[model samples]
Target: MNHALKERIIAQSKQLGIDKIGFTDASSFEHLKDSLEEQKAAGHTTGFEHPVIEERLYPEKIFDQPQSIISIALAYPTKIKEKPDIVRGERRGSFARASWGVDYHNVLRDRMNKLMAFIKEIAEDEAALTFKPMVDTGELIDVAVAQRAGLGFIGKNGLLITEEFGSYVYLGEIITNIPFEPDTPIENQCGTCTKCIDACPTGALLGDGRMNAQLCLSYQTQTRGMMPEAFRPKIRTVIYGCDICQQVCPFNKGKDAHFHAEMEPDPEVVTPLLKPLLTISNKEFKHKFGYLAGSWRGKKPIQRNAIIALGNARQKSALPDLLKVIEEDPRPDIRATAVWSVGEIVGSKGNPELEAFFNTLLTTTEAPEIIDEINKVIKKLH
Candidate 1:
């Protein structure tokens, strides 16, 4: 490994807007793979993670003969500069910090491409500098690559926490055949602080950087269909993702980076009106929110979560909107959630519209799940 070449690469990375650059050998992530397997056996892994754990553990599976991995992180803004106004009839839902700005996949990919281009220029006619760029959706576990590259330590909340940016950073990696000197990993700093754990509405943050993604509200919110009944109240107004743990971390207390302009959040999109989302058209949903990472699951999951948000808030004003969804929304999941919302919002209030819908629904709807939800809500309300 050439020291001057590493310096040149580091200098080039800074010029390309990469907030942090660290290098490590593309060796097997043995411990991480073992932990992942244990989690999978315990049925704790979110299905959204890479299905093949083998590829995640070994970077060679992605690019054969890999010698080094270049890990990069770009810091995103943690604070909302311009929050939108919510009128009397409106309740707004929140998107997570990661989903605040533009989709990070494209943004990180572009940066990795520039780094690769620079490496190729310097390696011209000499170094065997083939590379593979991986973002969030890529097979390699980004946090593992980042940790190996000395970018940051894995926080208890299952996020990479850099000294410079806390956990408010988007990570990506370029695995290359050319060997670069590896940096020493950053030491873990979450000593005895249970703030993130205590702050978690759901007990997802298991000790030693482990998490039960099943109980994680962040995963729960993203999932389509009915979320587990127990988690409904815990979610509150979070329509897309949860940030409770990150919000409470002492390291993240005041670190709000505005490095990348594209990573800046448009407050309106991040905190949208709950009612409009209940019936947002697909075309319109895409038009306004397609660029965001939170919109990845499409309208159904977000809308389903929105209905629950309304119910959790118990907004009497949202009653009519909830009723409309119960009557007209195509998805049984949405209608089912609305059924619960209608009851939860006006619990035993003696409203004719609600009582009548409940009376009629019990008799007409044959779906056991919907009827069960109706019965449960009715019982709770009474």
Candidate 2:
């Protein structure tokens, strides 16, 4: 084992502001296959995963001659230093803490790239050393890799819970040929605590360090199509990602790390006025939210969720915007959600103008989905 080099890497990691670093052998994650297959067979997976199962299970498949995996974690701030000013009757939606910073993908990749460069600089034969760095978007399951690397234990919420930083840490890894000694894995500490499972609005967490991703609110919000009606009410105010499970975890209580300046949230961006988001231009969304990890699915999902948030809040003041969306939004899904929101706010209080508007919309709209939504809203208004 490269004990001296490993020690140097650990020291370098601290200097690079990596909160925790650990090493593990690059053996195939064979134990995870049955669980993964079970999830896939049960339709529990979000379609966003890397397509091939083999690539996810074997580090050697992706990186040549892999002997070790160097996993790193960087803690992000759980609290925003400044909260956005609240405006009366102006409803806003939130993004989860994971989405609070500049895109964690960019930040982790930058750190890994720097670490790789440093390794090359200090290595006995730089040309012989091979390294493959990956962040969240990578094929390897980050939590599994982090746990094996001894950075943390996988909590019932399906998050890596570090002793010091809790689950508020972002994870990344590099596959290398170096035979570094492995770190000891942390044992699960959840110990009959079901706070996260009991707190889940959708029951996505399966209470065994696994989750039904299809039922997870985080996945539901990112989906571009119409969100299932069952999960709509569960969303509450979050427009992008759900943090309920993380929030309720005992390990996460009052643990906030403001180590990385880039990870500090701009409150206004993370929690923005819902109405503006409903009609925000593509260019404007990119300009405002492009740097955040949550924007990966684009503005349509965010806008759709914003419409849902308006309905969830029962913000009667947003009736005009919701009505405008129903009347003129180009996207059928947005129009459909807006139609639902209108019903949620007005709720059986017959509005002649709204009834007339929907009646007209039912006649004029071409989309079957929007027409169905309009009919439902019309029924509620009566």
Which model scores highest in lDDT?
A: 2
lDDT of 1 at 248: 89
Off by over 4 Å in 2: none
The CA lDDT at 377 in model 1 is 70
- Look at candidate 1 and give me any clashing residue pairs: none
Candidate 1 lDDT for residue 378: 70
lDDT of 1 at 200: 82
Candidate 2 has its poorest 10 consecutive residues by lDDT at 373-382
What is the lDDT, from 0 to 100, of the residue 194 in candidate 2?
Answer: 97
Candidate 2 whole-model C-alpha lDDT, 0 to 1: 0.91
